[model samples]
Each structure stands twice: as C-alpha cells, then as structure tokens.
Target: MHIPRWAIPAAVVAASGMLLTGCGKVPPGQQANVGVGAPQAVPDPARQDPSAAPSQSAAPTVLRVAEAARLGKVVTDAEGRTLYRFDKDTARPPASTCLDSCANTWPPVTAPKGRIQVDGVDRNLIGKTKRPDGLWQVTLGGWPLYRYAEDDGPGDVKGQGVGGSWFAAAPDGKKAGGEQQEQDDGDGNGGGRNRWAGWTVVKVRQHPRLGMIVTDGEGRVMYRFDGDRPRVSNCDGQCAKTWPIVKFTNWKKLKTEGVERSRIGFIERKDGSCQLTINGRPMYYFAGDRRPGDANGQGARNAWWVVSPRGEKITG
Candidate 1:
C-alpha cells in the first residue's frame, strides 16, 4: 500500500506499459457518530465522457486480491476528505477498462504479494473479483475497483466519476465520515451520493456531526465519528490536534456543489471567531497521519465510527 516517494514518477511512466489492477477500499470504525472540502480546477469533462466507451480492453482472465488491512487503512487529503483511486480503469465502472493507453494515465497502488499488513481489520474481508475480460481484480465486499488518470499524485481525487456515474472505489467500497462526502461530489452536486450501496441517509438534521462518504471495503458509502460537536475541543484537543476543520473566510470561499447551500451553515463560538461545526461537532486532524495515503485515525478512543445522516455507522 506504501508507494515509495522517489519512484512515483518512474512508476507512473512504467505504468503506461504495464497492467496494474486496483483494489476496493474500506474505512475502519469502532462505535458511532461523526462528521466530515474543496475546489480546484474543472478537469475536461470530455476525458471522462463515458459515452465514448472505454478505449481499453477488458481485464485478463485472472486478477489478484489484497489483505483487508491494507485496504482499510487510509490517508486523507489536506481538505479532510479521504482520497480513493481506481484500481483498474480510469473511467469504466465495476471492471477495469484501462488497457494500454489509459493505464499510463493512472497506475494501481499495489505492493508485493503479502508485503502489506493492516492490524485489527479482518484479512478475509479482502479479496478479488473477476472482470469481464478475465482480469482478476481486487474487490471490496464484491465490488470491483479502479484508480483515476487525472490524479497526478497519491491523494488527488480529480478522477472520481470523471466519466459520469462511475466513481473511485473506497477501501470499504464506500466513503468515510459525513462532511468528508463533500469532496466526493467533485461538482458539489448532492446527487452523486446515490451511488452508495450500504450508506444510510440523514433525516431532519441540517448537518449531522457524521456525514456519509464512500467506504469501499464495506460496499457502500458510510460515516465515521470525528468527535463530539464543539468549539473548545471536547476531544481533549487530542482530536483537534488530529482532525482540524478548514476555516473559510467567506461563503464564496466555501462551495457546496451538490449539497444544498442551506445545508451548509457556519457556527460561531463564544470565542467570537468561528469554527465550522456540522450537527455540532467540531472537525480536526490526528497529525498521526502524514500522507494522503495514511489513515491513522480510523477509530480513536474506540467509541468512534463513521456514520450517515440517519446515524448508521460503518464498521469493519
């Protein structure tokens, strides 16, 4: 699961000629509750046009499976959203469609067989599924996986649903945390949430502390608890030290694409300044996690797990 820092460029170049498959992802959780950023450039919608049909061929007859632990472990981007990539095709869904030309654009994150290990997560939960062209692909709860070509780095998720409804599979096949879900809807349109297979829906709460996002290994979108909603740091500031929420200066700085703008509200604290709290819980970072590929804060204090608006928790 660890991609060496120096070799990325070479691997990307070599990936063009090779066939690197992907694995479905998952996020780990303990008990319940939590919440979960960003606008870069609008990549060409054409490169992702699914109507074009995949120029790539189907996968080979056999594929590979990975340990569930590796898939469950995660790394979030600076925006606080988890980063997922296509395990196979850059655009195709369920099966990997990236053949020769497309493979170069996106490379699957793979380690030597048996080289990666994740603690606490069940190994049996991780395995592979067969793609139509015979390629043995990594699957999370049976769903196929892939990575995005548009993603230039390990954490960049620009390729998610690039070609339309097909999205990058999370380690659990769903997403982690509620607020984190915003990152998944690249255009900020709330509709992409429909793709989740196991995620629950929020009822009535304007912004639940826990928001739903994708968690591939579990086969649906899910939510994980970030912390008790607050501004003074009820997490003992231990949580605050880890999962810091992004502060936007103006409403214009904050763009809720698909989510209703009204659903997007700000909270002002006694401190006079403001901290963003959805459903009351303040967001933060663990610093325990370093890279976008590192997910050190899955379930802290043991009581935390990602949940959806309806309060459904995602656990592995």
Candidate 2:
C-alpha cells in the first residue's frame, strides 16, 4: 500500500482508551512511508530537522459523498479521495481490524472535533469508533472510515476492490460499486444470475501466492476450518462473523470448474442458512482476505487452511 501525503496539523495524540478525545490539526513532517509487514521508525515530533520540507495543509475535517465512475456514490474525505471500509471490520457494534502495518497502508480517517459536516449524505448516520490506539476513527453508518495510502491525490480509487474485502464505502456505509453484473448460472439454461453468485460457484484458480486453490465465483480463495466436522460447523457467533460461511442455494444448479461435482454438497447451519461444503467439511470466507487471490487466511490460528479442487486441505 502507498503512503498518504495528506497532512493534519496540530493533531493531538491522546492516551490509550476508547473515547473521543478532542480532534486537533496534524503536525508538520512527512507521514513516514513504511514498508509493508515491517515497522518503519517515525520521527519524534519534538525533535525535527530544521531543513526538512514542510508538510501540506490539512484538508477540512468533513465527510462528503462523491460520484465515482465505477462505484457511483462513495464517501470521500475532505480531500475527495475515496474512503473505504474493511469487511473484516464490523459495524453493528463498530470495530476495526486494519491495524499496525495495515494502518500504515490504510490510515484511519480520524474523527473531526465537534459535530461533523456532510454533503449529499445523511449526517445522522455518521458516528465514531474508538480505535485501539485511542484515536476516535470516524464511522459512517457504523462502518469505520479509512483512506488508501496508494491514492496519491483526490479522485483516485486504487483501493477499491483490494483484497476483495476492502471497498469504496457507500454513503450509508455499504460497499459501493456499480450495478451488479449478470452471473453465469452453472447449468446451460440461463436464468437471472443469483444475487449470491460471489459465494455460489466454485472454481480452481491459480493464485499468485497460494498456487492452485479452490475459489468462489468472485475468485476469493476458499478455506475449511480444521475444528469442524463432516456436515457440521463449530464456527458460530463471533467466529461466524470472522469466517463467514460459504452461503449458497440451489446446490443442484451450482457451477464448478476443476472441482469434483461428486464431492460437493451443503450443510445446514444452525441459522438455517445453507453452507457450501467439499468432502463434507464446511467452507468459509476469511474476513482478512481483502480481494481475489489473497491467501492471507491460510494457517490462521493453526486451524484455518485453504482448500484444493480435490476437496483436500492445502498444507505446506
């Protein structure tokens, strides 16, 4: 992820807690560009090089709705850069998962002091979530807001569709993208595409990092929880939230590529939702996986692992 060059002057760093501290302007100096997965040392504001170039002025602390070419109406920071929400993050209670190195790549949009201003969006839907770092990250409709580091300037939506989990946030805090494309219903007979096509069809895709692995219609890699049993799922409540079950209906009409049809099936979840299965083990989608081809969920918690077209776990 690219580092952001936007400045916030006199921005006060409050102590660690989940409370909205008074928002302040950002201080001067470059918001350090760090390598992904490695922590880069940031300069202490107290000590600085006098000859260092000054940082740019801070954009007004306003959240606005802008029309994006691909995603239509999207929430943007005062700078007009596309704001995003992570699927791994929750909204009902409001939380964030993009932390540390992730934070460096996708900086949280800090909450403004006092009431927030908006344009072409419902201000009542705006709220805030206290980050682990004590900063109150702004939330629209309970979804935390963020700015992509790769977006060099306003109107850049490089962060859209990243990791398949990050998306340009809609004004109401939903995923913002153009009208859904028609899906290829597995059988030759063409009916309207299933609204859940992303989780409906299975395929064998060549992931740049994970090699040949099983994926859903949207090309997101699939995984099986080791703790689960045949035709059963132990993931529920919070666990279910993190690893959303592969939901599908009309198993008979399911599509596949490189996957064994005989090995495919479905298990009824406690909530009565149908979860797609391979060789009896339940399938799931990891919240951490932001986009297609991402295998970030592999080996998670020594339990979750990617699946292969053969319905076998991909280990090693």
Candidate 3:
C-alpha cells in the first residue's frame, strides 16, 4: 500500500461522497446516464393512481435491509431502493431475462397480489417469479429482483455491477458487493478457486453509462494516466502490453472501502514489479477489458480515464 500524491485528490472527494449517496451532485465527467441503452420504461412511482391519495396509493412495497459500506446487508425497497441481480438471469426455476427494453431498465420487484412485506428477510428466502409481463417478480434465493433505473436514492447502490451482469442484493440471496467468488473445492469437479477472501480491496462499480467508477479485486476496471506524473509511470514497453499494471501481492491484506487509506500507494515499476497507486495515478488494466464490467480503457487515447473515488477523471 503506497498512496501519496497528496492523498489522491482528497481521497477521491471523500470516496465520492461516500460511494455516491443520492448520486445527484454530478461533476467530473457528468455522471447519471449509466450503462447506456436498452432499458427505458421509467414511470412507476409504485404505479400511481389508486384513486391517487394515501400518498399516491401508499408507495411502499416493503422488503428492507441496508448498510452498504462497501456492500454489507443490502436488499432494499419499501422505499429504500437498491435491489438487483441478473447475471443473465436464472435461479433454479426462477427466471427473467430482463425483457422488453430490459424490462424498462430493470424494474420488476413487484409483489402484486403476493402482498409482500418482510424486514430483515428470510421468510424462507422470500419467493415469487413469473415475469414475462405476468408480473409477480420478487424472489430472493431463487434470484429475480430488480430496481435500478439508474437508482436515485434510498441507499443507492447505483446498481452495483451494472453491465457486468448487475449485482447488489444479498440478504442471503447472495451478490451484495464484495464480488469475486468461485471456491468449489468440494470435489464436485467444477474446479473452482477464485476468491478474494473477504474481498473489497477497492470498491464502487457501476457503469450503465459510467455513473460510478473504481473497481478491482476481480471486478476489474481501474485506470488512470493522463500521461503520468506524481509517482511517474508513462506506460512503458508496448505501453505495458495494452495496459496491464495494477499489482499488489498483499500490501498488508489491503481491503479498502470507499477508498482512502491515504489514497493507498505503491509504484516502483519498470519491471521490478510493484505497481498499484491511486492518487499518484499509475493504475491500469485494459487488455481490451476482457470481462468484469470492462471500461475498455475509458477514454483511452485522450490519456485514459476511469478513476473517480473522487480522484476524478471518468471522461464520460
């Protein structure tokens, strides 16, 4: 862990106002457009007009739990927003490939006649799943659950992993942040082994149109290098083979939250190893962004982008 550059832009503006609360302050590169196309049915303030009264027909579909300091509890809705899951969608028999405009940008969390309302969750892992317009939706362990129309408030997880197959939603149904989990070892023969242990060596991941940035520990996407400076690192060799460098063997078990353990530092490259770094720039990873949220190198030629934990950059 090295971080320096005067503590990388006020610890990325105090971890981007603590992982983007309400997310409306927009600035460095604009924000709020997230993930781009396909998902546009907006309008459902819990479906207005039930005679339009009791606070517009009582808009509280209930199903709570929220704490997200890098994603802990999560799973919200009785007006608390944040709820997602859809790695192409499928949970045993529960399915929902995010239809029509991706179900108008991930809406389906309906309870309809199922009349939902659970607090700390676990009503036998909450169930329900039929959407194809048949409504129903809301399922917990069997997956199916949604929200994120670019999430505006209520503990806003900004839809956590967005296009990397969305995430955020764990009250046992799994996927509330931390990410990278593979571990199978039981001899089932799937041969697993990718684990960041307790995870979070750096957080914030979302990009419907690039609303949140900074990733790592398997969620990938992390760049920055306006031609380098502070701790210096002008690419190197074929630009470090398309842009690899983002190392950190242990760094004392690094496990950043919103980011800012003094901005976290470590440079020393030229091949002698030791790369990482945030406020002092020098972070990379874009061999064309093979998977995990892929930023494709954000703005690339204009000098790369995607940093923001308040360290700015982001580009668009």
Best by lDDT: 2
* Residue-by-residue lDDT tens digits, candidate 1, 69-170: 223334332222323433222111233444333444543333233422433334454455443333455544333444455656544456555544334444
lDDT of 3: 0.63
Shift of residue 88 alpha carbon in model 3, Å = 8.5
Report how far off residue 246 is in candidate 2 (Å): 15
TM-score of predicted structure 1: 0.28
**Which digits, one per residue and each the tens of the lDDT, describe model 3 over residues 19-138?**
222212223322221111011123434335343212212234688888877888988888788888875465644666565555667767767653778999887988887664456777
Estimate TM-scores for all models. Answer: 0.28, 0.42, 0.27
Show where candidate 2 strays beyond 4 Å.
1-60, 179-316
In terms of lDDT, model 1 sits at 0.34
Which candidate do you rate higher for TM-score, 2 or 3? Answer: 2
lDDT of 2 by residue, 1-316 (tens): 7422121111321222111111111122212111100011244432243323112133245888898886788999777989998754656456665655577788888764666778888988888888755567888877788889899988889999887668898887778985332222222122354444333677776665666788876677889998987766889899988999887555334655556444566654445466777877889999999977788899999999999767899885
What lDDT score goes with residue 85 in model 3? Answer: 81
lDDT of the candidates, in the order given: 0.34, 0.66, 0.63
